[model samples]
Target: MKQGTKGFVGADETGAGQGATGRARVPAQPGAEDVGRQRNRTRGGGTDAVPGRTGVDGVRGERTHSEPALPRPLPRRPVQRSSVRGQILAALRTALVTGELRPGAVYSAPVLAERFGVSATPVREAMQQLTLEGAVEVVPNRGFRVVERGDRELAELAEVRALIEIPVVLRLARTVPAERWAELRPLAEATIRASSSGCRATYAESDRAFHRAVLALAGNEQLVRIAEDLHRRAQWPLVGSTPGARDGGARLVADAHEHTALLDALIAGDPDAVRSLMEAHFTGAV
Candidate 1:
């Protein structure tokens, strides 16, 4: 498993599907080398090469001016094939969360691969993973389309999360030591910084990190896993809003500050304050 800046979310050390860290463990694909060789052959003007277009350094060039431009600029960091699929998956998630990939828009693998400066195979694999996550869906013979989640769905997700997490957090506050709660202050502060930076993706990870760290103190791995999944689903960008929009940024900073307040309540061993703060936190999450 590759370590991301915010850390991988779900995969365990053995590459099993679930873990405390939340990073995914991707399986290796066979014939990746064959795919690379085929791409090279196409670039070299082999049978796969199209007429009137030349492949330059593995990217097809000389567009006929008929292709539509991407709706927004994608992160263009070039990546290598060694563990490339997971890397691309992470990048695509960041894009999705940050609104670089707009909802209801279609994006083909080749174009995204070109943007990432990698082969299409890894990009396709990454898209497939996104499909499983409900972040995007496959559009037959075209590309993957970002899923548009509505306010109702977001509200329902928040409700489910509250039902699951609020009680557990309140329970932990009564028993956990003040020092244990103190340890999480940095993560709470990190969320504030991420929100202030105006990067939704960064704030999303930090937000998750703070919550996961809090939940992990309960020593219930299964509970942590379940809560994390619900939390992630809730974090998806809502429809009809630009990524990091002004209101959204303000909401994020407000939410980020709640983490610290929640921590303070926990440290004070005040379950009443914890309950109140947690309720407000989830309510405002929508």
Candidate 2:
């Protein structure tokens, strides 16, 4: 960024998605590719961020869903015969986020394939990809088991998000057309409304949409894709057994309000304010 004195020097990674060190956790899992193309947004939980330098190389291979945000993953029909691998990956991610695939429960590729009405190959491949995200653990002579990530991981994930998202947004505040950013207001407002509604899933999806809209301003598809992957990671479900698992409506409302403020700062083209706002948003998140 030329000693941090540049104006929108690089594309901002905003998405329909990651934490600082950990990935941006989204709900109702979808393939990284599908998340990118569909611009799926998600709500995140807390765990320390484990920043991964994941890019959008393989994910961009096949662009999928062009549909609006999904509240949950719908089962695929048996006759569907498109990119089967991507479908399985997306399905597993949805299962993971929605608690259909329980943490600590063992699931074999064949069983999951049966559920999705596909072959075992894609299911195994998708599970392998998830293994890299620390979403599941592989066992000898057994299938994969969902991994339980803790708050520490979520915090680290937030850190990674701050590193990736904040600066780009700040630059965008300086360089991007104010009108362009302003156009995203509806999406941001939807997040606030969803948050205020007190439904966790709706709020989560809206939250992801708002963030995705924010980064879309940079006009960089790849950046958005990478950011979306990170976002999904951060939104992965938290272990219910964890102490202090709070999901009160008050917190969502407050977070939604912050989203409004962040949008205002961006639309106002206040880079300094945008920086502070982005920082507060990332750090304040669990």
Candidate number of the best TM-score: 1
For model 1, what is the alpha-carbon lDDT of residue 280?
89
**Model 1 pairs whose backbones collide:** 8-22, 8-23, 9-21, 9-22, 9-23, 10-22, 10-23, 11-23
Off by over 4 Å in 1: 1-82, 246-248
lDDT, candidate 1, 205-236, per-residue tens: 99999999988988999999988878877877
Clashes of each: 8, 53
Candidate 2 root-mean-square deviation in Å: 24.9
Tens-digit lDDT track of model 2 for 1-286: 1365635332225632455655655557667787565332211211321123122343332323332454567876675434788778777776776666777889998888888888887788888989997799998678998998778888888898889889778878888887887788888889888776766556667778888887887788998888877777777777763212345567667778888898788777778888887888887673
**Leading candidate by lDDT:** 1
Models 1 onward score TM values of 0.70, 0.62
Residue 173's C-alpha lDDT in candidate 1? 77
How high is the lDDT of residue 199 in model 1?
A: 86
